[model samples]
Target: MTFDPTLFLPDDLLERIRERAPIHDRENTFPEQDLAELRAAGYLSILVPTERGGAGLSLEQAAILQQRLATASPATALAINMHLVWTGVAKVFSDRGVPGLEFVQDGAVAGDVFAFGISEAGNDLVLFGSDTEATPQGDGAYSFTGTKIFTSLAPVWTKLGLHGLDTTSPDGPKLVFAFIDRTDAVTTSDDWDTLGMRATQSRTTRIDGAVAAAEHVVRRIDPGPGADPIIFGIFSVFELLLASVYTGVARRALDLAVQTAQKRTSKKTGLAYSQDPDIRWRIADMSLAYEALPPQIAALARDVDEQADHGALWFTLLSGTKHRAVTMAKHVVDQAVLTAGGGAYFSSNELSRLYRDVLAGMFHPSDPESAHSAAASALLGPLQG
Candidate 1:
């Protein structure tokens, strides 16, 4: 059966979300209402197994829904992406016969919001390493002590899925992946001011000996990137979903450009801007760039769903797709702003807001530099040394 995204995220619900986007952006706050409505709709559990009281959608289907959600509210989609990443990871684990993250899947079904707490300032190693300290409590529990930056869903996440270096283990410097609750030891800083994606309110988090119970301690693997299923799950889901959101941003920009071209009339030509040769060419160029990404995103997402072994090239393909989506989104928004003319320069204009929101794409993981390096390594092997 072909999965229909509209069944989950209908147009009316999306219109409501779209209406609230500007308000959240203007206030620089989290989209609480959007979260409530989406939670009510069971959107948070779309990746969990149907037997577990979820939509049981594949990663490919989730990507399509994410793109649709992003078209209505990019910030909402981006914030929700963090929660979905954990559930998606759980699905990945379950599908591969891994047993640790069943709690994550169940938590999502029970309405527990899981935040991705892996990002740390100055820790460019990302999943490969962690600056945080993981102190084992002897009985398999671990206490995390470090500050994590860009902790999306900071304001409301019920559990945090994070990584830290457990140096005290006899195993010798294993990266411990665990889930900790928001206790008194955990502090969420109110410092999420940014140029765009403001509605996310992705505040910084400070963890001072926040402990993950024994059952919540998921993976304890050696660092520096290997074929761990957890690593593959995180990287694939994160990169593909990030790409899907930005692809939706590009789609919205292209749609706005078309609407502008059809509505705005040219004084010189005495016809709609759509009839102008230059404007038509610009729209066509935007269309060309926009048309290429969804298929790539869909293909990679399906490959993940079917567990198609892309082997060592997985990183390159994932990162490159993300890079292309973000860059293409930025380009389409730039053209949309040009097409809409000076009116779009105003802050109230949706095009202007999109112009700001799309700038955030370059900063996500698998950034252009990292993507190019992975691609280069795939093609020409690693640099000597």
Candidate 2:
């Protein structure tokens, strides 16, 4: 992934999305229109490789476009997170790496989506969790019965990648990536209606007696790290992507305030609210925060592109960006409310819609507390011999 500064988001498509954002939010429907537009624009298959029949867009471009999407509707961007995450994993499995890696390479190239069943009811699904179960079954297949909470995009996924704990092994918990065909499993409880990301469709996914053969499962040559790096990496991606979404929401808030002020004038002063000094400064400050966010995240994307390894460099930049994004959310939109004044409080205004949407960023798993800890660990000098 190259760090190209000239990169910009698909503005026209995003503007159309912005127009329909209110309806999507109001009706609590998945951003079907937004997803269609993204798919039509070749965004749904972004992580898929060029040889495989997908865009294979660079990290930088993906980030730019995702952020743009967030500005229109963060929930829509979130719904696609699982798709993109699994797409990356599929590519890795297809690529030449680890022992017995030759398998799935062709399928990956051909394009297949996988949804990870990682988190259980009690497990830290937000962070990578160690939840797996396996028992040998007839015909070299095994039954997997595990409860996974917060399974985003599970409703729309066909391939199920269950991260299970293989208890048969004496070596602690052997984390295995089990692949199950969608036709084999059932969503015990598929009802998903949420408070914030109303349209994300993040339902509780269940796989009872789903059988996946040994060949379908792909474990690392050595089971390198304890957990799937992709899942852990998702937290990092969530931070950046959600941050962009939050920033976009804030941008919309500012836009709404400006538009509201333009249409209304002070009856007492005979002047438009936009012309008022107080209003000018508020808009100025809001714009300043919005301008500051994209560059900060763009810089982080560049750093990630340079450092492929999810080591110190990636951790530092990614966690730091999450922290910065949360701060920016509080600063930009909170103040934008003041700028919009009394009008924004009314449910009729777009500002009210953005007000709730922008706040969703703060509640993501990458809260300031955990992010700060990661940042501090990164800053701490490696212990000298």
Candidate 3:
């Protein structure tokens, strides 16, 4: 009980749950009391494994407790950064014994294991593909009829990781998962209204027949070298927890752009754009990129947890620390929404939902084409360490 990564955010509760990010992005809602106060203060099992109680962190102490819970809600740290990458790929698929290893109740989270069912239903959300079809049945149980789109938590999750295709062993696709105890086998359609993390209900799950067991289906066994870049897999700790939840929504849009330039007054030099010097160099220039993106993504997640089985050099150091912390959290949340002027897009500004939850770490899964082809094969190696 004593591993304090800012105890998952406590300094008057991270500026009071970052003032509830503009009413959970204007009711596209689902912070659910900031994820039930970050899973009732266990801080969502920080990499769930110390023989399954967890806090066995070390993806550089779970990227400093996911950059202190994305400083305070980068859309609930990108909807709980895929529950620390589905519990670190379910603790390396339960130490390689692999069959399902279903331990989410290690202390009942009730939701989280976060989304990415690999898009379907007339797919084309920018083409990094998969179809998800699974239907196998003849007494080993299977029935995952697809349509599962974006799926960031079909109205609250309880662990999920599904990618189907199995109408009874018609092979090559089977990673199944579910603890969904009937949302009637999953159904959600309102295509996650987008343009940003908008409270990240990132929806669309629709399964009709989500049955499980064939030991709840767990088949992603990459001992390595599918040319190694899965950013070293579990999406490189979700691209360093989506660059520390977009550097905690660019440090809460640089503290609401330095409290709206010290409470406005500048109708052209009527002064007090916090005594402008180019709005105090864009609010002290996003506090030096929020104090240097949590120590360079905690030293590249401690060199990928000290070479966790060197999976292609921890997928080229978690894809060059998520391409330099999502290109420095997109120039520190677009210069904290232009030092929050034009009332930072008034939906009752909170730097307009930290300028839309810091652009969900700019095309997450550490975009920029797998961080420049894993930094050009880790500075050009004959790499496979």
Q: Which candidate number maximizes TM-score? A: 1
Q: The CA-based lDDT of model 3 is what? A: 0.63
lDDT per residue for candidate 3 within 4-78, as digits (tens), equals 767656776666666885677677777778777777776777666665666656566766666666666666777
Question: Residue by residue across 1-385, what tens digits does model 2's lDDT show?
Answer: 5543223336677678778766767776667677666666666666556775666665556667666676677677766666655554554434423333233333444444455566576554334445556655645466777777766655566667666655665563455566787765656365765545666666787777788877876552123323354544455555666666666566666676677678778888899988888888888887877788788777665544443565655655676676677677667777777876777787666666666666656656666766776677777864358
Q: lDDT of model 1 at residue 177?
A: 94
Ranking 1 against 3 by TM-score, winner: 1
Q: How high is each candidate's TM-score?
A: 0.99, 0.80, 0.35
Worst 10 residues of 3 by lDDT: 222-231
Q: What tens-digit string does per-residue lDDT give for candidate 1 at 4-115?
A: 8899999999999999999999999899999999999999999999989898999999999999999999999999999999999998898888899999989999999999
Name model 1 segments beyond 4 Å from true: none
Query: How many residue pairs in model 3 have overlapping backbones?
Result: 5
